[model samples]
Target: MKKDYNFGYTKVNSKQKTKLVQNVFSSVAPSYDIMNDLMSLGMHRLWKKRFVEIMDIKENDIILDVGSGSGDIAREILKENLLTNLYLLDLNKEMLFEGKNRLKKEKNIKYFIGNAEKLNFKNNFFDKYTISFCLRNVTEYLLSIKEAYRVLKPGGKYCCLEFSTPKSSLISSTYKIYKSKILPFLGEVIAKDKNAYKYLSESIDLFPSQEELRKNLLDCGFTNVETINLFNGIVAIHTGYKL
Candidate 1:
């Protein structure tokens, strides 16, 4: 007999983790966008906007948005009018369905139910790859990075936007209070899933620090790795170029 693996926060069986994650997303899929707006006070939009602007996409570019929930980043990418092919990949079918419904009118986009650690894309297929607030939830962080590198064209860019620990001690302390207390309460009220919200908050704490993530990207064969701390280091955008 094998001892069951328990993921912290959820403490769910290893076999059930995927289903639990899917259920969590499915339950929140309808109100996901609204919850994001509320949780971040509409700042996520700005962060994403800035992320797209920094990419400086060109016409006919192929872009992949992994963990693209509700197609928010995909919509922003389409607004650029530069991307001819936009692929939205997520593990949760419900999230992908919501994104598909939201982006039904956009002919340039496609949705795929896929895992980040094992992408179903050809090697060197994309001009740019981006995952906003998605990397932390991936089952295998380093494998995902390696797969991202493997799928990008030569010199292609891989960008990730995620919550990060604040540098300022005072701000960090204050943020912690909100994350541990208020965030779960808000989730219970809005998304009606306090456990999932708690998991999200805890995941941020477990995620790699900025310096460690930068080194991971470099170790995964990414060149020019850099990080941009946002909103007083509460969030960070990490960028790297595949050589």
Candidate 2:
């Protein structure tokens, strides 16, 4: 029996979901950054900045950034600590190519086309692991979380920045309207791919909440689990340590 997972609002088996997600990213790869600005009104940039700040990157720390779309978070981390060794991994080759193109000038940065649930790196290799706005789309998010735990060295930290449930009723209602109605419209006009953006909106709603994610981190042996809500919990940064 094949286990089912979400491909947007539609349910499919794990392999289909992975292929569907890859197609979605491939279709939107060219316009991803543009649509991000349009979708979040440039708030994603600030969110990533704050996400990196919370990481408190140190000089020469080895970092693995999973689902490292377009290298936005990688760029932010490098800006803070240029000496940090960075690995950017993504399932979609097009997305990885975009990231590689953007960070072409940076040193100590390597990009790989890979899956988050099954990272290629050896156990306890990375000092810090990060996945931004990417886990929701994974075929098995729990497996990805476990992989994050597996790859981080003892005493290393894991940070995940993602769209999460909102704290306020009014904002939540408005955000829902924007996501369901406005986002796909912008995707069509800007990215010329409405379905891809539709998946983005649907995926966010289906993703685990901050507390739920904190519990997952705890379950995976991540201690000192903490969540920092940004924009009133519309987006959140979850951090934990492998002790």
Candidate 3:
């Protein structure tokens, strides 16, 4: 039997969830970047900037960036090291095209319309794997993590940046209000799609906690799993390595 997955607050079968998510990204692709800036209050850029820095990209490192929406991470990585080979993958073609257009002048970069749960890459191919602000939206989080593990070369590193649970009660309460109220309001006024943002907000609430995610990486054969919390855990960067 097919398993059910979270489509935000909605429960859906895997296939249903995939199609629904594709539709959502397709609807918002054009305004995705702008909405990201407003939704995170311009902090997402800072997070990605720090994320790429932590990546410590090297010249000629082969990297695969999953769910590479609008190529923000790709842009940052290339800026640090233009010689690195980057492969950007996204389940939604619209989002991939958005990245493609944004990175047209960028060489040594390839784009693929692909699923995270089943990456098209061969085993032990990538020196580094990254996914930012995209994992909670995946239908099968563990499967995708395993896929990230599968594709990385031995000693390769994996990095994931996503919205996370806050450690403080005060920040948690305020963040809840911001996501449930302010996020949808900004989405409606800017992206004209309140429901999509509502779904995104709910997805973050449903995602696993930091410790749980760390255990997941360990179980999937990643060594030295570590997490760096940002904004008191409103967002986090998780890094692991296949050693």
Q: What RMSD, rounded to one decimal, does every model reach?
A: 2.0, 0.8, 1.0
Native-vs-model 2 lDDT?
A: 0.93
Model 3 pairs whose backbones collide: none
lDDT scores of the candidates, listed in order:
0.86, 0.93, 0.92
Residue 186, candidate 2: C-alpha displacement in angstroms: 0.2
> Which model scores highest in TM-score?
2
lDDT of 2 by residue, 138-238 (tens): 89899999999999999999999999999999999999999999999999999999999899999999999998999999999999999999999999999
Report the Cα lDDT for residue 43, model 3.
91
Give lDDT tens digits, candidate 3, residues 1-243: 766788988998888988888888999999999999888789999999999988878888999999998999999998785588899999988999999998999889988989999998899999999999889888888999999999999999999999888999999999999999998898899999999989888888999999999999999999989999999999999999998
- After superposition, which runs of candidate 2 have C-alpha atoms over 4 Å from their true positions? none
Runs off by more than 4 Å, candidate 3: none
Q: Of models 2 and 3, which has the larger lDDT? A: 2
Which candidate, 1 or 3, would have the higher TM-score against the true structure? 3
